[model samples]
Target: MSLATSIRRNLFVLVGLGGIALSAQGAAAQPLDSALAAAYVNNPTLNAQRAGTRATDENVSKALSGYRPTLNGGISAGFQATRIRTPGALTAYENLWPATFALTAAQTLFDGFITANSTEAAESQVRGSRETLRNTEQQVLLDGVTAYMNVIQAIALLDLQRQNLAALEQELRATRDRFNVGEVTRTDVAQAEARVADAQYGVSQAIANLSASRAVYRQVIGVEPGKLTFPASIERMLPSNVDRVISLGLSQHPAIKASQFAVDAALFQVKVAEGTLMPNLSLQGQLSQGYDSSISVESTGAAAVTLNLSVPIYQGGVEYANIRQSKELLSQARIEVDVNRDAIRAQAVQFWGAFEAAKSQIQAAQAAVAANTLALQGVREEWRVGQRTTTDVLNAQRDLTNSRSALVVAQRDRVVAAYSLVSTVGKLDAQSLRLKVRAYNPVTHYEQVRDSWAGLRTPDGQ
Candidate 1:
């Protein structure tokens, strides 16, 4: 019989403990999408970053406040006592209760266009924050993918180890039976027993590794891993060419976008600093009513309006210092944008290379698995027919087990590399994936709060 057919026939002959291990492998494994969805909703890291993004949206409204009027009112009541002294007249003392109430309104008419420039800067910062959120989403989703794959890989390795142990045990029993019938020596049976014990140790180690992977899955996905599904390789989803991947990263990666906005925000800061040396114009109005009760009660009311203009001659040299400082910051911000661009380009190239390497590894490993499978079958038949020794059969079985394990590892690496490559180009976001969840729009809160006239509460009533 052909060696390929022989392995299959022998595999079917396991109605024993080995068959149970084979059958117990995950039939309905958990889907990768499910883990990502869970992490999107429940991951503390992502949620915290969302909160940070929402906080950033408020800065725009604060900058816009400079263009709005402010009104304030106050009231004061107190008792006053006064004594008058004259050289040739009797002293007079007056005791009274006095109260005053006033309302004031102030509005900025001009401030070298500081309000407008500040508002623009804040808006750019909001854009930067939104991009930061996008980057965080990619990171979290990538983590979820990694964790899910680790669980699947761990389960596969553990199942393989269990099967190896079961196979070794059966081989040990067969060797002892042969020895009892005088077909094999005691040393051969002893060697088989030693192999079975070693296989048991390997099974124990696999169990530990699988447990550790499960814990990591729970931490990243916010729940225990349950029946992890076999990952369908996403190799076909890769870009057609490496150049396209780098192009995507440079144009669309969230980190690069965030840095671009940072540069804009810093430039606006320079404008804001320069505005401080220009003239400031404003309007102020006040109304006051006062009541007094002493010998006789009296009340008075007054109203006034004022226009104020301030030109700074020299502000203790602070204005020029601030302008110079902001210019330096602007320079730094511009350089950071280029830094982000180059870094993401490197990442795109690196992950693409990893994906290519892992793809090749999978192909080579699969070939090895098939070859080792055939070898094991041939060796077993030769040993039975007295052409191969028991040691040769055992070595062939071990080689087949190792080849299968290698194939499993290569498959896992292939999926992880694909995910990393996709993430490096910033396509691993919820919007890109079309995930079935309520998308958190930072603009929602910004729009609701930007034009608001007055409110102490946040847009979400927080």
Candidate 2:
């Protein structure tokens, strides 16, 4: 479509254009889903969180080490001088090298369940980190949506401002012609000139706003935005009411789940700390070889094994203090779950209300645009017929421009608020959105590292 025609009908009204439209350069419009996919795949903040979760996965491996045996080896070599005398009949002096090699292993039979509790705590922490990653993903996607819509809205408003400027410039020329013919006074032309200057300033502001939006789009979506297609309707995917929405937020929000997992981890940590006060049982074995180069002695080999038990006898009050500290942390984590729920509830209500209000505002803005468009046309004709003044025409034009701008903003708000609500309810993920991108599987990393005995490289060989 021509730029002028597109501006007049409003780009959003062209939703029937094959579910996709061509930009001014005749390229296929970039869909919002594509932008979201880009953000999911390439946004640095989201990827950093993924890395953090992978790092958290190592905690389980470290914790599991407590269940494994430890083996160590040692070697020592030295030169020795020996002198022997036997009842004044014979005396001998000799130089020899003595060497020793030893290997030792220790296996824990029991440690008051400390290993088990620590492993459990580590696993819980991994789960919580995964949830935190999910929350970060949701945030990145929401930011992507907002940035995408802002760019589109800025572009549309800029177009409207330029169009308004063109219209006012034309009006100024007409007013000057009328003044020359003595049909209007100098004051009328002056008024038209002032309005033109205001329209010019509006265009500059619109350009600056568009620039700002583009920069944000790049930051969030990981690429400069091309002509972005208006997002598909999310109303069908939304919950039916505020109550249902809040319920979803409470149950499905990643922040709440993360907090709950933190509570589990903290509870396990408390047990781990308490385990320190219990007796520890372990078995140890050692093998040693000693060699001496001399006339009579060559080498000796020996092995030994021992079962060891350690009962804590209160060396200090540190263990008790640790137990108390762990309990306090557990309490804090429990409270954090409730805090997340409350925050999610508040956000759900706020975004839902904003979404609903945006819908109403769109309707009102459409009506206002329609009315103001008609009023401007009428005022222009009346001015030509000498029934309306220059100020009336200028005011009518400004009203129409403002209404169009409001319509664009309302449209942007509706789309952004819908996505924000989805995010608040914890549904704004790659699977939920069905974006055509490979989803990052944090579980795959956790599973790969869990119970693994040895590896210097990560799952991705990094």
Candidate 3:
């Protein structure tokens, strides 16, 4: 073969291989559902939030400890010497050793609502923690959806840019041939070349955007996303009414629930503070055995049981201040709950409206894509027949590409909105969604450890 023909054949082979590689790379991308699931399981931020929730369950143990008895033990042995003198006379010295040991147990028999209120507060705190974790999970889920949609959008834009580049190359070639035949001006060829360059630049920019978007997707979903199949529709996932949507959000939103728990805890603080003004009764017992090497020089054992009462006299207004501070905190918590409810309602309205508008945009974009496709075909045919200029065909092609990209964006928006609405309703927990992983159950673990106090144990009879 001639050297020129050999060069041309090698160029064709390279182009073919490049196309195959691009196709394979696109195909290797993971599906969106799988990416989301992976994110749920592996995302470090979400796992950290889960750990925080588990830590909150420790409050249950703290609360239950108030109901249990406290036991303490101590032992001591010592020797002492004493010297006695009469005026200026000689002095006499004596040494003595003593040992003492005590084992003490105290059980709260009665306190003016302190222990009860504290336990209630701890329970509320646990609830609050779970809700906060749920809120964090929902936010993470939304971020994942956004990242996924962004990747899809960038990919679609990249495809459009590539197609435009190909079309522009073909047009440039045709214009060059026409110029050689003296049918088209040099200016026309230059314009075609400029368009091709611009299209190539567009392709480069799209690729950059796709890369950045993929990084974000990996950050949220905990893995590199692969090719994704578009959903058929997302309208079915949207809520029906704005009022109902707001109501559901207010009832289930984690922030609001957490605030409610805060209020409960604050109220409990007030009770605990009030309990300081009343007497506390406790049952106490002690048993001990010790040896002394002094005058007695013997082992001693003692057992005794006693009832004790402690009354708070005054603490320079500290108790009153605590009560006032707790009351103020309770008031702030109540206000926060209301504020959260209002904010959630407003967000529901906004997202629901966006979802509805996105549905319309999808329909309109789909129609636009169809119309622009036909328009581009007509413009291409007119140019071929010498009835239209190259500019006209190029313009139609650009419009068609834009319309297709818009359609993909609209489709993604619709799906994201659907997910947002679901998240707003607070049913976004893994168990509620029937996710594959085992849901973390804080209550079960709390129950298991709550009654086991630090110093309390089961009785011998049991």
Candidate 4:
């Protein structure tokens, strides 16, 4: 049988064990999409990033506060006592109670456009945060795919190891029978025994590897792996060529977009800093009532309104320093955009190469497995007819087993490389994959809280 067919047959044999593993969760096929969806909603890292983005949305509300008015009220109550004594007069004492109530309001009429520039900067930051969240989502999904494929590959390898051990044990038994009948020498039996022992060691290693892979799968998928269905090929969803992939990555990658937004925010921040060197104007009003229980024994009220303007006259040169610092930050932000673009471009090239290389590797591995399978059969037949030695047969078996293992690894790499390429081009997301889960919309939270005037709690009441 072809190596691919043999692998599939062995995979079917593993279904019963996989089913038992999932018995607690109720046996069902855990497809790749399900794992991705679970991670999207449940992975702590991804969820924490989402929460961070939501917090970033609050920057807009804080910036908008510059355009609003501030009001405050206060009340005070106290007792005043006085004692007087003169040389010719009797002592006199007086106690009086005093109370006051006040209300004050202040509004910023103008601030050299600092408020406007700050608000615009905050909005740009919000957009940048959304892009950052998108990049995080893509990373989480890619990790999910990688973890899922790792478990599958480990399981397949373990199965191949066990099969190799069984075959070696059968060959050892046959060699022993020949030794007993004087058809083979004691050295032949010893050689077969040593090969069997090595095969046993391989089985142990495979088991350990499988266990480690399952642990990683649990950590990433938020659950123990079950009867994982093999994922279908995604090549059809990929771009036509490396050039197309790189082009898309340069234009569509979230990291680049996020950095671009950062540049915009920094540019506005520079404007805000420059505004600090200009005049600030505001208006203030206050009303108060005071009452006293003294000789006057009456209440008095007062009201006042003031228009305030403050011109900066070199207050320690901090404003100028801030403007210079903001300009430097703007330059850094612009550089970061180019950095991200170059990074995405390089990733696009690397993954595309891996994707194509893995495809060719699969074909080459399949051909090697086919050739090694026939060679082993022929070597065994020749050994039976006294034309080949026991060492030759053992060598043939080893070669066949190695080829099969290579085939398994190549198959896994092909699938993973395809997914990785998709991610490099900025398309590996829940929306693009049409995963069966509700999408988390960062814009919803931003829209809900952008114009909020006052709130001690978040939009979700947390």
In terms of lDDT, the best-performing candidate is: 2
- Writing each residue's lDDT as its tens digit, candidate 3 over 185-225 gives 88888889888889999999999999999899888998777
Ranking according to lDDT, highest score first: 2, 4, 1, 3
The models' CA-based lDDT, in order, is 0.82, 0.89, 0.77, 0.85
Model 4 Cα lDDT, one tens digit per residue, 1-462: 765675455434432233323212465678888989888888888889899999999899999999999999999999999787999999998787889999999999999999999999999999999889899888888889888888887877787788889988989998999899999999999999999999999999988988898888888778888777668778888999999998988888889989999999999999999999889999999999998846456788999999999999988988899999999999999999989988888888888888788778767876676677777778888989999999998998898778777767777777788888788788889999999999999999999999999879988888
TM-score of each: 0.89, 0.92, 0.85, 0.92
Judged by whole-model lDDT over C-alpha atoms, candidate 4 comes out at 0.85
Off by over 4 Å in 4: 1-26, 85-88, 293-297
lDDT of 1 by residue, 304-344 (tens): 99999999898699999999999999999999999998898
Clashing pairs in 1: 29-228, 29-229, 30-228, 30-229
Residue 405 in model 4: shift from native, Å?
A: 1.4
lDDT of the structure predicted as candidate 1: 0.82
lDDT of 2 at 206: 90
lDDT of 3 at 314: 89
